[model samples]
Target: MKRGRLALGIIGALALGLGGSVVALRAGAGETDRAELEKRWADAPSRFVTVDGVRMHVREEGPANGPVVVLLHGSIVNLHEWDDVVPLLADKYRVVRFDWSPYGLTGPDPSGFYSTPRSAQLMDGLMKALGHDKFAMVATSNGANVGLEFNRAYPGHVTAMAFSMLPLERPSQTRKVDWRLKWMLEAHKAVLPNWRHREFWRLMLEDTTPPEFTPTDRMVDQITEMNNLPGALDRQAQYIQANVRAFQSSDVGAVAEAVRVPVLLQWCSFDDVISQSADASVKRFTNTKVDVINYPDLGHFPMWEKPEKFTRDLRNWLDRQPPAPAG
Candidate 1:
């Protein structure tokens, strides 16, 4: 009995030691990968346009003659989140997408302009630099916050606006993580071993596809690769910690009240991040016939989940708006 107890103690210590080593190794790998990704971004194709003494990374696509539409991605996601949406809209409109300062390939802002108001100012400068005096805006999540602020500051430039999966009010409590993080952390329990979460992946692919089709493996890889960006998770965590109040305190009511431009508020009924109650608040601010489209099957990333439907709906909405006044 004494010998057996001693062996058990030894085994426990060994197990603890092994676990500690594994964690240390993982920490080291994470640091190395993050550095590599930052270096890669150094050579990435980006235009540094001066905005309020800060140079912001910007990218534009499609015809110079086309109407301008600025696409703003969510907190962690860069301009690439709109990759699928941009091509569909590009034929009709010049699509402008950029990593907001301090996230994704854009990296951190050297000028310390990281808040929503500062971001809006940078965006305004970006549009001006692009020679677009007036343009439409489309935003998701935190990007929506910046978009609304930009509209408030420069309503003359924003002709129409579209918002997706955006929170209406500040969360009542702190420490609440975004829906995407919750899903990933939960899914990691089963996903990390195989480096995939089949159910989550399947759902993502199916959501983006048309009603009749399944998404190919390549499509799944394309998305998973984006999510696997080094420091992507860290950057998102930091942004949330630093700016949760901004998201919560976002004056949806104020923006809605002041915005005279056409607006489309697209909310996914099933989204866990931005609650449905938040969507209801938009009506309080605007009677401009707020075009609210609720998708019963979609999640937070609706553009990826239902790309075709999302694009079609967006295009249809844009088509209804009269052309902007020529400068």
Candidate 2:
């Protein structure tokens, strides 16, 4: 009886403390209006289009008649991640970048689904909307998997693909989360209010990138602002909570095997998130010609760390590929 009373008292105290902290912090931490964010972040080429009931924030540049090149950013980031590389490509190929649901100005998906197949479908819909029946793809991390899935589901639409930091784990591997840790994670999500944590991102960037890479203030600020938007944090939390099932069931090896088009693996040796080596990933694509170029000094985000060199290397690869089928 005494122990039960003690536990109840502790729970009450924690609830009161969290509530007080939430009230104190929520003044400046409230969700930023979506329109206000659009005005600030959306540039000249930016447009919102409805795809599968989700209004996607997309940007297009270069000549309309130029061959299309779609850029997909990794998880936790939006289309702005390609800002550095866009200018270099825009004068030549038609450059396209967009924010996937639950990220950037796109916010949460109404359908509440974020599987790789769904992402592939959305990409096809977006490209179709833009009159691109086929295009090349350049993607990183989670986005790279989306590209692989796109090639599998839509096939032939992706004439060529260049990827960096592809997180392709096998279907047989499973992550077992400790029940105590899972409970704590749930508690943390429940008790804490949704808000931007710039310090968390700063630490993450510092830990993930090499010493040569310094995350600029603008990069931190933009990410912070994006996460602070309404429903963004909740959506991200929901996605993270589903990771054990999602990662385990992913058949990336099968997807890679289905690729008949050429592939470029832009590997970052210092990447802390994915495997530092690309040998395993290269072997997975048994059917296709997989060309590799290693960035020995860079980490997860080579484009942000070395934009000019990244663009130059990517442009060279794209130049070598045969032209896509006419739309």
Candidate 3:
């Protein structure tokens, strides 16, 4: 009975501490010396490719001749998010991962513009520049939003879609916002500075990751290093500020409807913010297969949370789908 009480007390204390942290709202860190940051965060399989007029950071692995799978990571995360998952599919499928502007090693957008449409264009052009006319795509978080645009803009080029943390471009679920949600949204905006902080993101990962999976010290350190990439914080802030009013209802649904290839959506059952997108996209998608798998424990990034399980499930799902077009 004492132990149970102690556990409850600890939980309550943690809740209060997190709540206080959110309320405090700290400023994000500025970039350290460029040379130092570049040396620390630039990992293997790195290359620079000129896409359209913009230079992007690319990481290519697996057999060059194999069917290609392009990966788009979540906001505030770099291509390394796919590090574990890459090898799982690399031998059988060529994997291409890149750092989109305003994040990762790619740095800022030269045009000072960032939106789903622009990112979609970048993805399509990047694949083409890599000599891949047709490929499958996997994106997470905001990356999924860009993937929707990619499919909408260049349907012929994408053979399959897999999106985790997919954002649905649909009408607000409610016409009225209660004080709590309104307050929460406002508070989120108020914490804009911390959004650029690596420690904040690290704490988020710890709070969000399921108990079954433990994020190693190395994992957290690597993620923090990426967050501290030179100029990334400023670029990300600028992009978000520019895109405050970006999406309209049906914008994402229309993209989903236009997708003519196999698509898989993986969501966590408890994730109310993004899991609903699976249902939203499934209803809108008509031309090709749209499948959803809900994990009992995983959060937004199931691929990172349960890499092996996610890879196995993905491989099985891909096997069941119509194979990609020949190289």
In order of appearance, the predictions have TM-scores of 0.72, 0.85, 0.78
Worst 10 residues of 2 by lDDT: 170-179
Encode model 2's per-residue lDDT on 1-327: one tens digit a residue. 999999999999999997887776565445677888898899787999999898989999987777889999988788988989999988878888998666788746778976667777888898889889888899998788788888888877888999987887722223333455445445546654476457656655666678878899878877878888877877876755454466666554567888888999999887756742589888888898999998889877888999999999999999889866443
In the predicted model 2, the residue pairs found to clash are none
Candidate 2 yields a Cα-based lDDT of 0.79
User: Candidate 3, residues 1-327: lDDT per residue as tens digits?
Assistant: 999999999999999997776555342334345456557666566778887678788888888788878889987677878888998998788888998766676756678777778888887778878788877888888888788788887778888888777766532354333455455445645664334454455555655566566776766766666656555566777655544466532354566778778888776754444535556667877777778887878875677888999888887776676656544
- Model 1 spans with C-alpha error above 4 angstroms: 1-28, 32-55, 171-238, 247-252, 325-327
Worst 10 residues of 3 by lDDT: 170-179
Candidate 2: how many backbone clashes? Answer: 0
lDDT string, candidate 1, 256-315, tens digits: 666788888776766665543644756655646578887777766777777889888988
**Candidate number with greatest lDDT:** 2
- True-vs-predicted CA distance for residue 118, candidate 2, Å: 1.4
Candidate lDDT scores, in order, read: 0.66, 0.79, 0.71
Q: What lDDT score goes with residue 212 in model 2?
A: 72
RMSD of each: 6.1, 5.9, 7.7
Q: Relative to the unseen true structure, what is the C-alpha lDDT of residue 144 in candidate 3, on a scale of 0 to 100?
A: 80
